[model samples]
Target: MDDLRRIDLNLLLALHALLTEKHVTRAALRLHKSQPAVSHSLAQLREHFNDPLLVRKSGKLELTARGNALLQPLSEALGKLNTLLGTAPFDPLQERRRFRLALSDYAARLVLPDLMRYVRVHAPGFDFAISQASRDAMLAQLADGELDLALGIFPELPQDIQVQTLFEEDFICLADKTAVPDQSGLTLAQWLERPHVMVALRPDANDEIERALAAMGLQRRITVALPHWSAAVELLPDTDLVLTIARRAVGPLRAFRQLRQFPPPLQLPKLAYQQAWHIRKDMDPALTWLRQVMADCCTTGMPSG
Candidate 1:
């Protein structure tokens, strides 16, 4: 058996390039080194492997039987090394890397438009897929690298994950403009007394709006319950009153040109919408770019209280 520790890293790279391109000039181009440099490395690999890894056949370079057998493992090992060294440059503008984010419809509506605009201008080639998943499932996907980010009001997050506050907003009332004296604000008492539309991804015990209301010795009269925030906006234009979620959910409703915002009558505990991701990716260049871009979009597009 060969002493693996005696192996030359550069020879392994040469072997990989040779197996991939099968031609000296082409492999040199792939390595961004001169043809002579690649040829020299190929000789070193041949001596190390004690076999001609590639041979000329019908005027084209072809791999030997040993080379053919070594290809898969060699490629896999080189790939592991490349990833560890972060050699694969992340080109969001050209690389079709897909990112999945788990967020509620409200958060998506609030943040996605701006996020898309940024991608169009900056990372035009990258794609993002957002899905509404349960908090547990979302966290699991994030931890397992199946999801890139989660945007919502996470009351608690795993210690292995890192959360950054995007924005904090107090609860507000959404109603027809005529319902409120001034469209700018509402009193807590008015919010408690009004008929509200409650929105949630699924039937859950802990509702942030309700919790905020209860802390103030008040509770909103939730006349209707819906699964998504967009549905609530659709209902807002026809009805005189409904509780419109503040921060991210407000702009989408106003775009429909029917609802107005009011300061809640009483002080409701402000909810902090955060962006969470795996701690392992904290220093990754690609992840950093994504985090900054989304965070910028959140701040620039969503109304911060």
Candidate 2:
């Protein structure tokens, strides 16, 4: 630890620059120092590590075996340091990064399209993997770095997990146009009588609908239990079923004329969709950009109606 503490931060910066540029002159230019100064720094780095971090081959500088192994890890460490120092500038248009995202199918449907379109045009080469996992599993994934971000209605997480509310929406009733003659408003009694598609995707997810009903000594006849909202909308066209869905789902689900939406008369709590990340990544430039893009997707073009 003493040896680690004695090392100069500037020297490590020079090493990082040298490893990245592979040329003493270019590294010096990157560091805004003279070539001789950078050469002196490299000499000190070799003495400190007791290895030739870079060697010249065919008249061009190349990394030695030890240096080659350090490239990836060194880059990652410096990135985190940059984030910590708050000196990293996020250039989404030029950054090539693939982030892992965990989201419900409904959020994927509502958020991904707009998010992709924004980055697809504004920031080229950005890639994402959208996945679905339970909140506990996803929190574990975030803690372990297997996932970069998660979006949905997650419970209160540990301190290590950071959450940002993207938007809040209320539950609306979806029914086949033909199944309900009155499409304007659905009363509590009407909702109780209809056979419903119970969207119990997870133990905690959307269970509020049932809880609200139970509070008033009522329960809808559950006709089907599916893991995703996509199926519930599909069932509405052919079945006499009512689906209490998030307001955001109304836009895409509205595409199916067979399904029409009505505001349910239950005083259910508003559903808040959020983005979660490990607290460690709160300042990461790329992750911050991704979060902003997601927030924009949730808010744009959905005025009060």
Candidate 3:
């Protein structure tokens, strides 16, 4: 084991190449080393292992007993080590890399459209895919490398995960224009009494807006409870009542003349939605670029809801 440390790492590469090719010239070509260099490496490896690793028989190289036993495990270890070292670093525009983001429907409506616009204008070649993951699962995905980023209120993030709050927004009540009396407004008490659409993206805590209603000795008569804002929006036109949602979620709904936004009745603490990623990926260049792009988009590009 002590002598093993003295062996050159490159010789192990040469040995793996030789075993795979079974010919000196072919191994040299594969390794981009001259045949004589490969021969020299073979000699050195034979001396280190104290066995002729290969022998010529029937006009082809045949592995001796030690060589045959080493072939499978050696090949496997070298393949894994090579893959670990050979993982190409990510480059944004030049590389056609795909990033998967885990976000709730509301976040997609609030953030992604503008982020996509930015990507289209700047990093046109980059690809993105989005999937719905509950807060707990999203954090897990980020840690596991299945998700590149998560933009939402992650109150339960693990201590090892890194989170950066991009912006803060408050909740707002949205209703069809015609639903309100005089197309003007309704009191906070009146708003709570009416049927409402609810979003339960955070399974553990009741949304702050709901708590505000409860403090007033009132509770929303929830007509719908959905996981995504997009789903909530789809229900708006069909239902004749108010929808409780984050202010940022209304950015993409400007085209809907039927929906009118009203400030929440009682003051609710602003929702601090953040971008979170695993600390392991913090220094990864491609991921760093992605974080910067998203942070910029959150700060400047989109209109605040």
Candidate 4:
């Protein structure tokens, strides 16, 4: 008990990093310490535990049985400690941090440009890496601490995750000005007859549109499907096809294309986008500031197009 009390707390943090990464270099990177310093800490940890916490295997580091045994309890304890300490009183302007984000295409368009601008003005050294995967995949990454936050039409998040509604958006029709010929709203008959292009980020993404049209005993003729939003946009300029996209997405596309926007002929359900994080990060001061940045950016840039 006395020896436990005397052990430095930072050593525990290094141990947690080492267990998580199973590599000295990555653990050092995570702890923001030099590799040699982390190596020394690892040696101390070995002495304290009296076991080879990590072992070389096939030219890569692997956690030993003892290290694997320590991972879960250590992670839980550190998470509690982090929540209690509140992340060293975060100062965004002075810190060099990298935030990994998982964003839907709509959120990226509505929030990212403005977010980047704000970062340049206030937190120059802060950087962001964005992933455009489906919300479920991103949320999984968030739960594992591989992603800092995910924002989009996320659903069915785990109970230990927390979410905040960022904004609500409605769908709008997009088409090339020349191909569409008529800038006025598409009639129900015309909308049903025109070939539709789809952005297939999720399998049921068009369900809302389909349900709305089904109410009128009408069906859309979706002739082409693209996996990417950019590809969907590229298709519009030449084909006599239209795509219904979230309101937040259209504004940013205007700088690139002269696309015409119209209200969807069908009454589509509103989309609520949310930002989600693991409960473990709920008290992180830096993450709190970033969520606020996202909120502020969304408020200012809510789809004039």
lDDT of 4 at 43: 94
Spell out the clash pairs found in candidate 1: 185-262, 185-263, 186-262, 186-263, 186-264, 187-264, 187-265, 188-264, 188-265, 188-266
What is the lDDT of every predicted structure here? 0.73, 0.78, 0.75, 0.77
Clashing pairs for model 2 are none
Top-scoring candidate (lDDT): 2
RMSD (Cα, Å) for all candidates, in order, is 14.1, 12.7, 14.0, 8.2
TM-score of each: 0.61, 0.66, 0.62, 0.64
lDDT per residue (tens digit) for residues 1-305 in model 3? 78568999899889877765567887788689999999999999899899999999999787788887876787667657756987775655676678888877767766788888777766788898889877778887875557888887876766447888988988777787778644446777787678877777553347777677677776667777767676676677746768877777766666777777777666788888899986445445677787887887778874332
Q: What is candidate 2's TM-score against the reference?
A: 0.66
**What lDDT score is found at residue 14 in candidate 2?**
93
The C-alpha local distance difference test score for the whole of candidate 2 amounts to 0.78
- Best TM-score goes to which candidate? 2
lDDT of 1 at 27: 70
> For residues 36-98, what per-residue lDDT tens digits would candidate 2 score against the true structure?
999999999999998999999899788888887776677687777776887747677788988
**Candidate 2 residue runs with Cα over 4 Å from true position:** 1-88, 184-186, 203-206, 252-254, 301-305
Q: Please identify model 3 stretches exceeding 4 Å from their true place.
A: 1-91, 120-125, 182-184, 201-205, 214-218, 237-239, 252-254, 302-305
Give a tens-digit lDDT track for model 1, residues 1-305.
Answer: 26777787777877877875576876777578999999999888888889999999899777899988887787667667668986767776765667888988778777788788777777787778878887777887876667888887777876456888988876656777666658556655665667878787665545776676667666566687877776776676666566756655655443766567666565557888888897545545666788887788777762222
Query: Which of the two candidates, 3 or 4, achieves a greater TM-score against the reference?
Result: 4
**Candidate 4 lDDT, tens digit per residue, 1-305?**
69769789999999987876666886787789999999999999999999989999899777788988887788788878776876566677888889998876656766888888887877787888888876667876875678999886755666446888888888889877776667786887887888998776764554567767778787778788665765676677756888987765655675646678888877788987888887556557788888888887777652221
